[model samples]
Target: MKADPRGVLTGTHFLDGDHACCEGALAAGARFAAGYPITPSTEVVERFASRVPKVGGTFIQMEDELAASITLQGAVWGGAKAFTVTSGPGFSLMMEHIGYAAMTETPCVFVDVQRGGPSTGLPTLPAQADMMQARWGSHGDYEIIALCPNSPQECFDLTIQAFNFSEEFRVPVMFMMDEVVGHMTEKVIIPPADQIEVVPRRHTRKAVEDYLPYGTNGDGVPEMAHAGEGYKFHVTGLTHDEHGYPNMTPATQDKLVRRLQNKIHDAIDRITLLEEECFDSEDVVVVSYGITSRVAQRAIEMARERGLKVGKLRLITCWPFPEKRIRELAATTKAFVVPELNLGQMVREVERAANGKARTFAVPHAGGSVHRPEDILKVIVEASR
Candidate 1:
């Protein structure tokens, strides 16, 4: 076992998904954070608040979710990797800032431990209802990355991946978790600091006079200059020019928005991550993510036991929606069975991607609890037939 350093507890230990996520952020060099307290998601920042100071960082419990969301972006511009955690209604409160983060190309992470919700739906219970919200809750035409982790270990692993993706693309990355996964305890092994890979911020190498806060050298992502390093740069949410100044013209909006979306769209192949178990003759494919993926796996096994040919596709990266892969699979697969904790969220994506080439079956759950394996298996059996 490697010795623990600064914030890395470098060994195996039992941890809930929230704690593991905090450790992942620390390991990924998140030196600052700001968040408001909310159930199922509060422990992530509670641990962060306790751990960050020892590592020469800061964690501020902001007045509300909106303040917490924007404060982290301030920390990011000040040259620190940062994040915020929230659940349900709190997640809804942060939408405007999420759009701001996208407009300004802020590199930060938002850890949303989802719970049942229309308004204060189920604070302590599980739900995958936030899937579509993570992608489109924020008003705007910009793009962001979102990841779903089904276990404690993945909660640790994918949070680091989330931070890395944010820095790499200079966009906000959503770390989506459900209450069940967030509170589920399991063994999570933390690697030594030296062994962990952290993506450093893409600071500008140009002289102060030569740097433009939003100026890019061809690849849509711009080099960032710290807030107080004698770099005169502007940051705003309006349609902006390369200099980060408000332009507010149709031409500017078209150019800016398309670049924001295209930077991600062009790189979708590299960004999408999935775990698959498939056979050439499998007729039904179970498409799922987050904690529901685990439930779907059990259902898939039961279907196979009945001599049914079934495959599993677990989404580790949910946003940007693996359209090409689903389209390709639809050509050969007989049907797709999408089971989610929400009444029907990601199944719509499956139906869209399948494009009628394959029949689509949805197994919807209304948030308080996960679907029974039999429920999912029944859908699989129906889809197969």
Candidate 2:
């Protein structure tokens, strides 16, 4: 294998998910990150701090999670590819900044290595309780991209995708990883930089006089103008217009907010990613994501061994919830079995999308560990029947 001129570590190696996440950010051209130390997630930035300097990147240890979250956005406005990392309470603290990122249309990433939650629940344990929070943690009417990785390799690959989505949509992206996936060690194959595809920031080419900070370039997403670029533009968390000025009128608010959301909602098909196994005529479909998807696989196999027609849908992009696909499957499948670390967060989405067409069963766990294969199998068996 040839060395990557871009300084990416291009090869296969045994690495835990947190470490692999750092490598992914690096490979994706993330040159700046701000983070505060937090369990199950600190390692992502810890590795980044150590490894980034060699690749011409910078990692700042912020005073707290809020600071860490906002700082990365500042970095983005200054023309750097940036992200931040946290878990549980830290993630909660960053909600305000997350909303600010949304309102300002900052292109950045936030990695949440989820542990058991509800305020300092379990620091070292695994849980998917943050799924809803990732979608709605910040108040308001906005859409954000979120990717769930069930393995170390995905941790590497999806982090890159996370940054790319942030750039493509000009929105903050949530890279949701449970503690199990964060700490679990596995082989990760990182290809050469030349093999990697990165989306460059959509910087405005129009003259400073011609640029509107929030103006679109055909696509709903506005072209960004970095600070110190001889272009003048304002950014605020409040409702703003094409010039990025704060405009509190209902009409301005309506137009700005709708554009912010429609840019994502309209392109849902392109943003969603899933790994699926279909049966010719399946009786049930098992829906899962992150580490729980791995556990669900075992349960799926157990049900299959018993001659059950159980299909699988593993969510790679959790947000922009794949309701269309779920609704389509609802028409044909008898039931949907969702097994997740939290007590039925995503199952609610499944239930809503199913719209009573098919029965829905949620196999929920409290999050110290993953669910037993037999427990999920029982649900799948029940759903099949």
Candidate 3:
């Protein structure tokens, strides 16, 4: 379906990532949001709360991050495309509900404007440290889509993708932004409503009598019925049968859990997104994402001027990790230099994918800010040699 013309802010304007994300969500048909304001991410829901009423939606400022996180899920089951925004501490509070969203096959979006942290480390500064936490913070076994936006332009573009992926796969999609991207202002061009294609919810066509909440036609993703649809269905976080009834059996566990993981695992190629530059020919590839990708671009330019065969791989979708691409590059590139705001999280994924076929270097930062071009260039030079 095309976006609503009324909601589409069709024009070019200077905006920051958080505001851009809010615009993207509105443009993509997100009519509901529940959030607790925190650090850099606060602007997202702030904009949503102010703008949503005009567009026929609801925005709730929950008492806490925990309420905000799960309240969005309730909105989703009630038949609205919903999302929430938070920073490090709020994100941590939302972990349990993230797992709940996964277990119940709830389609929702979680925006984490990452700040340096274990608890409340540098609440107003940037960090990519949450990369691992986004994947593993929720516990149990499941996969979720995670996208990183380096610019306000991408921040707008990728939030739509995040919602689409969530609806299509019936899974939570993580919109991982950093404090730098969230606060940094840039030009954002929002296109006309007709130009934007949106994925509508795959609501079931089945009659209420025959509907099985957990029943799949063929694909792993089951059809959904809204709460008031009279579908007579059930959904729970425990292991369940096709009818969505809790069943304490190994057979149910194996089938349900395996299918949940396999839906994403099998579609990794389609879900994975990367922005590549000269990687096919360059002996050294500098891999980075989010704000760090922009920083790495400068290093790539500097290395090229120095007559080095350096390439750039900017991860647009960080989770689902682009292992195949990295593995293929491992056979060609001499080394992979990963620069991140964290000490080294995603660099480990690059290294694991590269295995022993190529050397991998981590250019880590404890976060609070971005990496300097020279620091990444230094790693690129070393990797090239």
Candidate 4:
């Protein structure tokens, strides 16, 4: 596939988390970014604000996170791939509007560079504490696509994937990162723009008179036409019908909600991505994500040298949890160790998927740093014995 001249190509080079994320959004063909400057995640907006104009895109720093998020929604409605970046507090402030994005079937990317949480915990420190919140931060029942990156390269790559998924599914995709990945400097070789595959938002070719904003075909995803592109359509948070008009009727609400929810939920097999190493023969599995995956991998290698039957399942996409794979591994593995920087946010989902068959344990670290390999190895050894 020819890379979009606008996309980032593959290679290795060192870059800070924020820069790589900005580059990823650009490579994904994002033409607009609106965000507020918050610690840890501030650099993401700073970099994007400076670079977006160079690519003929718009980047605005709103007065606050709430405004920033809603601005991104407007940008997406205007026919541009849009995004925003924030930390825990800012993310909290954006939750109501995030719910609005979800309810409206808006396609946009939200990059949350997590720091210590619950008010202003730690501005510069890293934390994976936002895992559960990312899944249910909003008020209603909705599905989210979130990707966590362990390295600067993965940060860039996954940011692009987040945009693609959000556009394809018409949902808000969160690019979940920590201050560690956000601030760390590493070499990241950006591929030539021509090598990146940028997925554009699906548009209907029908005439303006024939367009239906929320009308669905076989796939539950409604064909969307950009505003001002000759398609007069209404978009609101209120329950509506296929034509996008306001409909307070319960039947219309049920049908609209079910279709919106099913469009992504039913495509679980297609949306979830996981990486399993030494999965077949291993009796013990170490499940990890983000920067913690690196520690888990090292622990697995050390355990292997000590004659321990340990493997790993590294989650690339955190949301729409890989329940099927977790179940399969749980059926065979003796125990599963989940090591994370938080006090066990994602482990709950792992346990649920394990269905009591696999004994799940969590090795958690609070704010500021990642779990060391030795700590994870200790858990592995204990589980093996």
Candidate 5:
């Protein structure tokens, strides 16, 4: 389905990552948003709240992060493409609801503009520390789609994809942006609504009495029923039967839990999105994401100048981590230099995937700022050797 032209700001404009994300959400048909404003990411909801009225949508400033997190789910069930935006502290508060969104199979989106922290650390600085939390912060066994946008341009582009993935998989998709990217300003090209292709909501066609909210078709994603539409579908945060009623049996638990994990695990090949450059003959590869990817490019160039054959693997989709591609590259590459704005979260995944097929090194940064190109180049040069 093409976007509604009314919501699309179809032209080029100089915009920050946060504003670009807001524009992207508007373009993707997000007509409702609920969020407790927080730093770096506040601009996202700020723009949304200001623009939603113009685009025929609603924006609610909930009391707190928890309310904002779950309220978006209510909006989704009410048949709106809805989401919330947050940063470090608020992201922490939203974890429980993230679990709830996963358990109930609620189709929603979470825009987390990351900052340095365990607790209110560096609210204004950039960091990618939440990468692991996006995958495992929510308790229990469940899977979600997470994307990292590297620039204001990608911030615009990937925000649409995040909504599309959430709708397609019937799960909350995380748009993991960082403070730098969220605040950085760049030229963003928003094409006409007709030029953009969007995935329409998979609304169930069955009658109210025939609907089975937990029942999935061949693709493992159950069709969603509109709330208050006479479908009378049930949604719960517990293990549920096909009818969406709580089912306490261990067997029921296994069935529901496994499906949640398998739906994403099975689609890893199709869901994993990454960009590789100069990998054909490079001996060392720098794997990074979000704002860090841009910083890594400088390191890649520096390594090249020093006679190091370096390539780059930028993770466009962070979760459903590109294990296969990493494993495949491990076989041919001499090593991988992972530079992250955190203390080596994703680098561990790289090491595991490499499985000693090739060595892996980390150029860890303790958040407040990004890595210096020469710092990453040092690691790249070491890995090259």
Candidate 6:
């Protein structure tokens, strides 16, 4: 709980969500950030811009989200860990480049501090409406790691995890944050520098002339060598072979795409992170993520006190949805309830994972409001009976 010499807290301190996220990215070893100012997410960039420079990092505010995303990609290729922060509208603008980053297997974090709806619907309000979009926002069949955090402290912790996942899988990771959590001020415990496990991108110790940019070993992750490191390499959106050069042949393209997808899917059991509280004895399970999970947790406790068998699964990684865990719960639990600030986006995933073994229901709320624990408890009580 003591403050580090740097004045960052090792335990809990009252801090805004934006500052927590910035600190998390820094702690995760991010060396560059490029972003354009957008509501509900601007503070994240602002905080990073101020802090990054102090740590010998680079922060640039680009003209728009497209440029911001592209700039981060360039920074990553320049041998620095990089990221960008934006909201709904800006995320839409960044889609094309996001697809590019995915196709090229770039390791970077994109923080989406979610606001409401299509085209800036509720700029300052909380909404998990982008849950589905985070999975398929960019075109094509590439894999991505997306994490959602329910509290300010988690906003710090999971941002680090997001970067680690991105680097490990060689994919773009999304940090999904709702306005409620992004703007709220709460107690956050920043761990000591040594206590935090920082995962840097894998680089080769092989001789410069022997390096192949996309050459994979047994686990399918290639050692990445940046440009200007005296390592000749090619990077592009087009399907490329192990050397990173474009391969237009259908067979080669197929191999490239499949590897990109499978590397992530095969690691799903390992990459999927979730927290289950009181999962074993429950007849009904409340599935939620981000801030909604907090509500669901309270609801489960109240339902249990009322002699109802209820538990909660807090999704830490939203993308590559926790199918294995959900399947296990489906076989044992009687019903599953999902609550989100948006309507039915994540509940669909829950139902798919449940596979008809348990009834899946959604409690959706939007327009600056959050689902209350009493409302979630009511559903749990009904399911328990």
Model 6 agreement with the true structure over 327-361: per-residue lDDT tens digits: 98999999999989887888998999999999998
Q: Write the per-residue lDDT of candidate 1 for residues 287-306, one digit (tens) a residue.
A: 99999999999999899999
Span of ten consecutive residues with least summed lDDT in model 6: 1-10
lDDT per model, in order? 0.92, 0.92, 0.92, 0.86, 0.91, 0.86
Measured against the true structure, the TM-scores of the candidates, in listed sequence, are 0.98, 0.98, 0.99, 0.96, 0.98, 0.95
The deviation in Å at residue 305 for candidate 1 is 0.6
Which regions of candidate 6 deviate over 4 angstroms?
A: 1-12, 279-281
Q: Assess candidate 4 and give its TM-score to the true structure.
A: 0.96
Ten contiguous residues with the weakest lDDT in model 3: 277-286
lDDT (Cα, tens digit) per residue for candidate 3, span 74-115: 999999999999999999999999999999999999999999
User: What are the per-residue Cα lDDT tens digits for candidate 4 across 176-215?
Assistant: 9999898988887788777676778888888889888888
| Candidate 5 residue spans exceeding 4 A from truth | none
What lDDT is obtained when candidate 6 is compared to the true structure?
0.86
Better by lDDT, candidate 5 or 3: 3
TM-score between model 1 and native: 0.98
Count of residue pairs whose backbone atoms collide, per candidate: 0, 0, 0, 14, 0, 1
What lDDT score is found at residue 28 in candidate 3? Answer: 88
Total clashing pairs in model 4: 14
Q: Which whole-number lDDT from 0 to 100 does residue 241 have in model 6?
A: 86
Best of the two (2, 4) by TM-score = 2
| Candidate 5 structure, TM-score to reference | 0.98
